[model samples]
Structures are given as structure tokens and as C-alpha cells.
Target: MYGTAAHNTYAQNNVGIESPTRLIEMLYEGVLRFNAQAKKSIKDGDIEKKVYWINRSIAIITELLITLDKTQGDISLYLEGLYNYEITLLTNASVDGDVAKIDEVSNVFKGLLEAWRESTNVA
Candidate 1:
């Protein structure tokens, strides 16, 4: 009975069960979803929604960078000013309701994600 109850709790929480690759994949998918929503919001002429998703995407990217830095030892230099560039783009896109900057940063992240996945054998 104890074993069965423990298993039930584990299943409920799904903690300590997910693979790291799965975690990264989920983050990637979330960022992609945010970008898609941003595009849709732009098409619908909703500046607020666009900004919302763009901000969300930037937040995710920031988290990813943090994770990478923790695991990889100061990769901010490898990014080579890209982080600042993305922040500027994010700021401009949020202020101007323009999606071009957001898309550019999203593409940059997509490339980074792909490269990281490949290097980590998670792809």
C-alpha cells in the first residue's frame, strides 16, 4: 500500500521523472508558441497581445540563457553582443508594435536552440 501511494504521488507531480531533453524541448516549444502568438496578434492588429507574447518570448530566452550559463560557463560571450541586440529589438518591438525585431530575435533563438540540441545530443 505504501509503495502504491508513493507511485501515485510521483505520477501526480511528475517530478524527478522528466528527462532534461524533454525539459529543453518543452521550453523550445513554448518559445515557438509565443512567437506564433505574437505573429497572430500582429496580424489581428492587437499591439498589446503582440507585446505580451514578445515579452514572454524574451523572458523565456532570458531563462534559457541563464540555464546555459549555469551549465556551460559564461556563454554570454559566445553570444557576442546578441543578447543586447535582442533586448534592443524587444524594446523597440514592444514600443512600436512592430514584429520584425521580435521575429529576428526568435530566429536567433531558434538557431541557438538547434545548435544546443545538436551539441547535447538532444536533437
Candidate 2:
């Protein structure tokens, strides 16, 4: 338990020291992970888990959307649209129990994550 607490603190500190790009990359990774869990929950017939994980993904996407610099012009607008679309997809997936929607969102996030990693030169 003590080791786990120490690890958590270390992880938090590491994140605090990361560049802004890396932080965004982390958010993308988080959304991807949550979406995967949501997909698995659906496959396992765990409705509660499905909703929880999908909601988690949506929340992260919301955070990303809110953090966007609208003053950045076209790119920010484009990202806002994409993030909104992903949130809609996630909401519909949760309501309809649609695995395909989750897959679609996951793919979108994966692409974004890849782009971020490439741009930031993050492993």
C-alpha cells in the first residue's frame, strides 16, 4: 500500500513536470484507454462499467475541448468540432450500447494521439 502511494505521488510529480504537448498526449492516451475499457465492458455485458468508462472518456474529451485556444484560428475550430463529435458519439454509444461507435471514437483518438506523439517527438 505504501509503495502504491509512493508510485502515485511519483506519477503525479512526473506529469506536473511534463510539457504542455505531453500533457495533451497523456489526455489522448487516457481517452483511448477508457474507450477500450468501455468497449470491453460492453462485450462482457457489464452495463454499469460500460457507462462509467464511456463517461470517463467523454469527460477527458470535454477537458480537451475546454483547453483549446480558440484564438489559434482554424486548427482550434477544427479540433473543437472533432472533440464535440467524439463526445456525441460516446453519448450515443452509451445510450445505444453500440460497440461500433466506441470503435470509431477510439480510432479517431488513436489518430490524434499518433499525431501528437509525432509532433512532440514523445515516445
Candidate 3:
């Protein structure tokens, strides 16, 4: 327990020290990872695991959507729409066990992640 607590504290500090660009990159990567897990769960016929991971992916997309800065202009608006659509896809995937929906969301995030890295020089 003590080691776990210390590790968590260290993890928090590590995340806290990153630039905002790096943080966004991490979120994008997290969504991708969760989407993949959700897709796998769907394929394996594990409804519970599918819902869990899809919800996780949706949660991250919600965070991204809510944090969009309108001051960034049209790009922010575009991202808002994109994130909302991704959430919808994930939600539908959760309900229907549709790996295609998950795949669509994954592709969007993968593109976003690549573009984000290139634009922000985060890597």
C-alpha cells in the first residue's frame, strides 16, 4: 500500500510537470488504447468489458470536448464537433457491440494523435 501510494504521488507529479501539449497528447493516446481494448472485448463477446472500456473512451472524449478553447477559433469548433461524433460512435459501439464503430473512432483519434504530435512537437 505504501509503495502504491508513493508511486501514485510520483505519477501525479510527473503528469503535473508536463506541458499542456504533452498532456493533450497523452489523452489522445489514452483514448486510442481504451478504444482498442473495447474493440477486443466486443470481438471476445465480453459485454461487461466492452462497456467498461467504451465508457472509458467516451469519458476521455468528453473531457477533450469540454476543454476546447473557443479562442483557438475555427479549429476548436471543428474539434468540438469531431469529439462529439466520436463520443456518439463509442456510445453506439457500446450498445451494439460494433467493432466498426470502435474502429472508426480509433481511426479518427489516430489521425488526431499524429497531427497533434506534428503540430505541437510533443514527441
TM of each candidate vs. truth: 0.69, 0.90, 0.91
Instruction: For candidate 1, give the lDDT of residue 112.
Output: 71
Tens-place lDDT digits, model 2, residues 14-111 = 99999898899889999999999999999999999999999999999999999999999999999999999999999999999999999999999999
RMSD of each: 6.7, 1.9, 1.8
lDDT of 3 at 23: 87
Q: What is the C-alpha lDDT profile of model 3 across 45-123, one tens digit per residue?
A: 9999999999999999999999999999999999999999899988988988999999999999999999998998765
Model 1 ranges off by over 4 Å: 1-16, 70-74
Candidates by TM-score, descending order: 3, 2, 1
* Runs with alpha carbons beyond 4 Å of true place in candidate 2: 1-11
Best by TM-score: 3
Number of the top lDDT candidate: 2
In candidate 1, which residue pairs clash?
none
Model 1 lDDT tens row, 26-111: 67666778888987898899988888888887786676666665445456566635765776787787777777876887787788
Give one clash count per candidate, in the order shown.
0, 0, 0
Model-by-model lDDT, in order?
A: 0.75, 0.95, 0.92
